[model samples]
Target: MTTKSLSIPLDFPFPSPKAHPLLTLHSKIQFPCKFPLFSLPQRIQFLRNQCPPKCQNPNDNNNPVPYTSQQEAHFTETQEAISQFLQEFGISAAESNSIALNSPKYAKMLFDSVKDLEEWTSWKSGGDGNEFATLGFKEKVAYMAKEKGDNGKVAFLESLGLSLSSSMNVARYLHGESLPNLIHKVKYMKEILFSDSDDKRLVGKYARCMMMNLSIPIDEDLQQTLSLFEKVEARRGGLDMLGSSEVTFRCLVESFPRILLLPLDLHLKPMVEFLDSVGVPKEHMREIFLLFPPVIICDITGINRKVQALKKVWAFDKDFGKMLLKYPWILSTAIQKNYKEIVSFFHMEKVDKSSVDTAIRSWPHILGCSTSKLEVMVEQLAKLGIRNKKLGQVISKSPQLLLRKPQEFLQVVLFLEDLGFDRETVGQVASRCPEIFAASIEKTLKKKIEFLDRIGVSKDHLPRVIKKYPELLVSDVNRTILPRMKYLKDVGLSKKDIAFMVRRFSPLLGYSIEEVLRPKYEFLVNTMKKPVEDVVGYPRYFSYSLEKKIMPRFWVLKGRNIECSLKDMLAKNDEEFAADFMGF
Candidate 1:
């Protein structure tokens, strides 16, 4: 559809109102009251002296009459001047404010307005609107995006599932980005404005922040850089991030605006590909980018050196990929300044060299921290009655323990005290499972306790249950614990039996029903012809690998006419089972 064009008309005429009776020039020129006619310039000056535009004449006495020849000449000259001014600018008298024509500012405004109109007319005559300029900002953007062959980006923005106002707001926002062709750049930036999926106000906020922060006429090479960033986001589920109800994506750009200016192929691509090669899963790339956007932008040699230090120098035997996924900010830490001292400190503290990566994976933020800060954290843990080798074990198990400030740690201690645990018990619990320190005691821990209490574990028994299975305090009641217990109940275990099972085998809550319970129980009920009581009595049956150990032994025992129970088949190690049960 053809859009209407906007333009200024060249032939727009000024309208003239009815002239003053005495000021009107008749066919025969005659002066009123037989006054002698002055020269034209003098006549104009006499008219100005009679009545200025904004004020009354000072020459007149308090009582004034209209028919004096001087007044008549003055009024006539003033009318001629008004008529000439309107004809000069071609402005209609009806449209023109009489007060406006008398001021110097109005003359300047007329000059500028006329100049702009002339230029616009000339351009229109030569180039006609071409349909582009006539389009609204949004349609213009879509046309430009399509012209650049960026249908994917157009589709990407359209798929945001936003309202019409929100979509137009985004279009307007991206147009204001000052991109040469906004289509390519808009894809990378979609997340920043729409981070809160349903909030339209952020669109305005994002524009303001960009106008304040980003230098403009954005550099040309930055487009390619931003394109690479968009490729990364696209790979990492940009829509899902944009769909987030929280400010996850907005926080990413705010934290790392420099990511858009880095060299993509030379620096960013290689670094990201290197991380991917080494085991950084695509899922975790967003986290890595948000946390350490410089991972790709920093000196490639430096990033490589830091990575090598972790892999070769520190000897991270645990899966480096999983470690990177866990501790993405570790990539931002300096290799030369921080890597050695931190590794050595952990090593000196009795954390095994290979397990250093595991420790780092658990609490990646420690790699960014100072050795002295870590040492202080250790000393604080020591004051809590967890010192020396015990403190090292805690750090190794839960590296995030080092990240907690001294006061936050004290709060956890105080919170645990309120929960009826003594200092010694807290120390013991922390030593065994340092991850408990990371759990939200008020929410996660409290909910777990409430769930346990609802399920028949008494207040007196709470400490014992938690001490035995501390992970239960942080486990999702709906996702893990309840689902597994519901499966047990569906199979005929009563609530009392299930509660007894939880007390007897609290670790069973950690195993998956799909992977562990169903297969083992199927074997016990269907294969062994055993009752549900067998599984209830021995919950350890769920922990064994079905193919590797459990099934192989069960079939061999059945072939040999041996009546081996689930515990007997799984309890023995290879050599012990061969010697004792298999007749080796």
Candidate 2:
């Protein structure tokens, strides 16, 4: 039967003509001044207690709010008649009584609202009414209870400014936790959130910001979160976190609030214990978590398995911690599976397993990349005729080559190729100075080419100069190269002479003025008694060892009292020099 509105029958015989028994029950069962939120079952218990055993309305005979589940007649209509008939939108019975006594029109409007709730709870909204209608009376009641909860949670998050589209996103990770438990968690988080600061910032909107910018926790308790912070605060490396342990804990909560849900005993302690056992230092723990916050939640047993597998392969049982310190993401990724692929690919290419381990030890993030990604880098290098063991050596020298986009890696190769290097010589340059592959094409490499051109290495000489010393692509122009040039020009070498010397050696600009150029040039002038112009002719003089080759051979020439040019003296093989000078 479908009655269109909320109307008590003309023959509701028990209560006064204007009085609604549902509203009158508000005064009968007195709750405290403070009202608490209730679940569906809890609110229904209030209904069952207040609703009379029988209340009849004999207007003709149709129920004004018909239930799709006819069995609702047994529990809701006949059993607890007035309870299901009143306004139920957070209205305590007390609020209902106030409306009944003072406002007859408002009471009638409240009565009319029950029709919508009745249709909604009885499978008329989205479910199969025919199928729901066949369920047992108690089963139908349970279904309505769950519907209220689902709607309430959505309303709660939406009220916090989470869009309806994304309100469920944070809930997905919570794994079906109840709404009351979520409220309990949010309530405590609010206490900690404003206990120190942001209290004044969000004073007028305290409840609104309690979700911590809508990254709310759904499955944890306040004590659970506090215990996790306590464990982190008490760690030996605890001080390394933003000064004090308490502030560091707050920083983690601020940056990665999901850390609140990770259990200390299961994830935090086990991870720290495993790391300590594996020789990872206590001082590095906080830094590791901050660098890769996901590491705090990674499975300790799985991480230990990866460490054990790596130990078997690298045989660097204690040294493995160094790799972790370099790239903490190794624990967060598929380290074991990726390492196996790296080992197999290197083995197939005839590169040693030790070389693979060395590559990972230097750039452990490569162990996170798939073998297919590594193969793409290899194919790119192979285009420059770098293949087989040469390929492996290039990768070990610069694992970042494996990390670059194929286009980014190719641009660097094309930059070299455009400089007139044949593919094979380009491959040789890559092998010798693998760091060049990592240089930014526009910012680092182009700026370097411009510096070379400015220093009198013309278009014709640029390729020859870079191919001779690929470190030119990687060296800092102002910090390393320009200072060396400035020192050379300051030391009585003209721009022309500096240009000629660098054109000859190509690495002259890359040499350290303090270490190599100054010490060697001082010895050449003061002790060996050579003219400074002598180096322009044989600038490769710097290439020879100062003490072993230059000093020893010059002393020989001085002893024999024979005159020789810089090249004639230092360029000859030891055997040739001895035979000629000693008359052997």
Q: lDDT per prediction?
A: 0.54, 0.58
Q: 559-583 in candidate 2: lDDT tens per residue?
A: 9999899999988898999998878
Give candidate 1's error at residue 60 in angstroms.
Answer: 33
Give a tens-digit lDDT track for model 1, residues 298-381.
777777676787677555644877766554444543423455677788777776655655566665555556677778777777
Q: Which residue runs of candidate 1 sit more than 4 Å off their true CA positions?
A: 1-311, 314-336, 383-392, 414-425, 527-530, 534-584
Question: Candidate 1, which ten residues in sequence have the lowest lDDT sum?
Answer: 13-22
TM-score of each: 0.49, 0.57
Instruction: Compare the candidates by TM-score and give the number of the best one.
Output: 2
Candidate 2, residue 337: Cα displacement in angstroms equals 1.2
